[model samples]
Target chain A: MSNQMFHTSKSFDQDLTETTDLFLEMGALAGQQVAQAMHALIEGDMHLAHQVVEQDSAVNQLEVLIDERILLLVAKRQPAARDLRYVMAVSKGVVDIERIGDEAAKIAHMAQQVAADNSGTYSYHEVQHLSNQVRLMLHSALAAFEHLQVERAFDVMRSDGNVDFEYQSAMRALMTYVMEDPRQVSHVINLMWILRALERIGDHARNIAELVIYISSGTDVRHSDFETVQQAIDASKIG
Target chain B: MSNQMFHTSKSFDQDLTETTDLFLEMGALAGQQVAQAMHALIEGDMHLAHQVVEQDSAVNQLEVLIDERILLLVAKRQPAARDLRYVMAVSKGVVDIERIGDEAAKIAHMAQQVAADNSGTYSYHEVQHLSNQVRLMLHSALAAFEHLQVERAFDVMRSDGNVDFEYQSAMRALMTYVMEDPRQVSHVINLMWILRALERIGDHARNIAELVIYISSGTDVRHSDFETVQQAIDASKIG
Candidate 1:
């Protein structure tokens, strides 16, 4: 009877490992969708924009699937301690990813609007730069999650401040341009909305990085000072 | 031996009940603080705004306390099925409440700015009305949570649209006021930000209500059609 119980427990642990692997797969797909959306925006590819919108539904579906699976695992297995936190983190991480998908969809929608306007007056270079920065941050954040790299996750968090700073500058620049040339206000406003959406994407990526840190370190570093979070991570590694 | 086992299980259940009750108490306090912050904004009471800001730390403390307690329970009890759902919901609920507190602090900060200017140029009546609506919605949402009243929660979700509409109108009115007299633009802009913050409060309240429904019905109602959510709630109640 003891031998049978051990075998069953081992299988259950294997099942959980598989589930975690699936979650990582879903995360990678969601990240790809976000990056593609950014590319569509920068390249002015309406087809790609539409594709991103369509792909968002799949991301949303995956969020629901992952949530249900986590719920079932918690219900059936009664996960304790670290395993409990891992499941909970997966649930919240999926939410962050879904929101990222929504932000990507918003970007795609804005891209469509910009395409329709046929203004050709506003330069896309600044917007492209901001998009690339956010995409890199998101990519790094997801990679950090897969590898359980606390330092990489912290890097993602610090990168968020740069995204916000750039977004603020873009806002000011766009506002000044609109103030000077009222005719271009509509186009500039559309671009501003896109920039805001990208900045929100960065925020969600930061949230995912924080969740990664929490799951790996078993500490709630949310709203903590940056240096404090770094110290907590280091302590967790040592302990 | 069976009697001793029964006693142990009963004590464990009682502890969980007590912990859940504590979470509910904390949630209630957070909701009240949110309402008071809105009141401060409408009344232009800098003192009350300061009080709200100070009280926010207490809310943050409660969030941490609740989180730690929940983690301890999961580690100790190995609760299953519905019990797991309840604990997970409480954890998520506390986070939402903390965010609600943050939004209240935001509104209070904006109120301080408005009070400092001492400009009677812009009346707070419209924002006051919107704040009242959102406050009531938040109160009802929390009450629905306490009672698990799916119908009332759905009502809260429906009211979100009204709050959004009011906020948009408020924004247009503020923009028109600023356009008419550029001198009061700064004050009006501050008020606009306050209104946006309140609208976000409403959004978060709706999110909490949706979460409550999810916990009670085991259904993911997010992104579902309004009629579908209502139908699901009705089904849950009937069954």
Candidate 2:
């Protein structure tokens, strides 16, 4: 994250910097895919949804490229201590970004399915709200990662609680719709799947934020902050 | 997996062997948690379900320990070529194993919720079958990993299709049940969550099998096998 974290070799530093930049670019693309999928879902635009699906290949390709770069960087340079941790975290964290891309593509596929069905009875307001929360979560997490902002990373982690709350609300609302009209069961289930993917995207974003924290502080902060935030999230949900 | 895959470095070999053993133990425990969660759902065994939930901590701890070991081994030994690939695969593969643990814990939580409801009218035969398929899939994948059997790994990847099919069938059946009587919507939804976790467990297993093939043959087998297998899985769902 910071410029001076490792100083053993200049090439290793450049490789690390380039790899992180590629990961950020991939993260940004994934965020766009999630947004575009939601746009297509909301506006009933199958064309954009198809584009989102097609774009996922680029994200996957980036992951493979990042992996190859990491393998070369680690094998050739042999980073020690903090430098090694940074490479390891980036290699692992990029997978989360790739999976976030998968989730986005899944949302787009559901959009395509709904578009094919040609049903205009549903508005998908809940999905739109939750996915916006998810996008913000991922965006902030990526910012924390790019800048190595520990405070921002914690903020992103705290924001994940709100995103999860939105996800559960969306699921509950979809369940209510299905219960109201059994004929809409299929429609509601499709939206439910989209919501599930969006919720998971938020979770993955939180994982990335945790990675930033791990890299910055050299301490794993997984369950530490989340539980307190989760308790608050749950209490807010109940109240 | 072969004897001569990596050059003879006794301590690196020992570290690799020990790290892999930890991963296998984590995988097996995740498999058991999944199975026990289903058993608790079927038999209404709240005690076993609670145990499954509690046991997830051990799995998490194993992942952390394995990660620490991996970081140390990679930094100290600086393994090259095949050895480096093996370490990378194991490091990434272990995360899948950890996620499998999360899915199992999720299933157990759903079991706990259903058990507290104390309703005996619902039989989870479909879920039982699907979770069993998932367990076997993961079990085979881990065995393939431990023995470095490329053929067996391929078989595990192929078997993921059946698990996906079973997952769709279970979802369809649950949808029908909920549509038939909306009063049982909550019950059906709970079972649906369990099935979703089982489906993801299968997906994770397939990812691990991919890792096994990657380590064994020195080639990434993801897009190669999954595209072909996914089509069959999708076709089976329709027909």
Over 4 Å off, model 1:
A1-10, A36-54, A112-126, A178-192, B1-8, B36-40, B43-55, B112-125, B172-192
Poorest lDDT segment (10 consecutive residues) of candidate 1 chain A: A1-10
True contacts kept of each: 0.26, 0.56
lDDT of 1 by residue, A1-239 (tens): 11111224775676566666676777777778877877787788999999999989888888778877877787677777667777777777877788788878888887887888777487877787888888888888877877678899999999999999999898778766765665564577678768877887888789788877887788877677898898889987897
- Candidate 2: which docking quality band? medium
Lowest summed lDDT window (length 10), candidate 2 chain B: B228-237
TM-score of chain A of 1: 0.91
Once fitted onto the true fold, the runs of candidate 2 whose alpha carbons sit more than 4 angstroms away are A6-8, A118-122, A225-239, B1-8, B118-122, B226-239
For every model shown, the clashing-pair count is: 0, 0
User: Residue-wise lDDT of candidate 2 within B1-239, one digit each (tens)?
Assistant: 33345556777777888898898899988888888888887777889989999998898888878888989999889988768888899889878988898998898898888887665356778888887788888989998888877667778898888888888888887877776777776677788888989888998999898887776556666656566544443443354
Per-residue alpha-carbon lDDT of model 2 for A71-165, expressed as tens digits?
88999989887688788988888889989999999999998888886653667788888888889889999888888776677788888888878
Listed models, DockQ each: 0.32, 0.50
